[model samples]
Target: ASPADMAHIAAANPAAVQGLLADLEAMAQELLAYRADSSLDTAGATIRAQAARIAELERDAARYRAMRDGLVSGDLENNPIGEAMYELGERVCRERGHDAIPTAAEFDAAIDTAMKQPTCTCPSGDGSLSWPCPQHPPEVT
Candidate 1:
């Protein structure tokens, strides 16, 4: 209705106008409540996602720590190759400082390269057989 018509009706029936206003106010309050509930639902989902990500990160960190410890202690597989690699890693760390500890991927690559090298039967001048054939040492690249 036009403003003029509404004003005329309101003046003629003030009680009806008051009732409509009350209904409109209640509808506005309900809409506000619904909006607040929707926002809370969205926030809850975000919090859940972040919590899951944190848990995943914690698991990854634990696995990495275990791998690092195994590699450093030469107890990963209790084999010759593992012992050689651990000794080599220790020597490198001693020479280059602890900050030079290789990541798991780098260590794996080095092991793969060492395994691919041909074995040598000839003993060194010191009467000891070193890893990676000694004569044809695995390239560091």
Candidate 2:
């Protein structure tokens, strides 16, 4: 999280204690998976990088756990963004059909689309959206 986001949280007084806890749990699970894989047959640079990432994730999860504990014990207002993030994370964990983990085909499609220069196929057909179609000059980056 950026300092600006932290400041916003403080200002918004987000009552995101449960959300924070959920985030911590999710991160812990992910880190555990990384740790397990790294400890197994994996070797070389990839394993090293995975181990390092897990370490960082563990540290971060600790921070969030502390924050969740603090929020539960302290007085705070509701943090919409935090709650939304938690809900999204929980939804993913539950595997609610809304967001199933991408399979190889989905991943390949994403890569293919990303690699292709974005084409604007909007109804407007104005040359001001993407490229290789009609629109150009992307609206926002």
- What's each prediction's TM-score? 0.47, 0.24
Worst 10 residues of 1 by lDDT: 121-130
True-structure Cα RMSD, model 1 = 13.0
lDDT of 2 by residue, 11-91 (tens): 566567667777999999999999987867466777799899999777556545644654576544454324434555565
Q: In order, what lDDT does every prediction score?
A: 0.69, 0.59
Per-residue lDDT tens digits of candidate 1, residues 1-141? 999998897777979878889999999999999999999999999999999999977755654564566567865565445665777689779888987877666565555554443445445423344555545555621
lDDT at residue 33 of model 1 (Cα atoms): 99
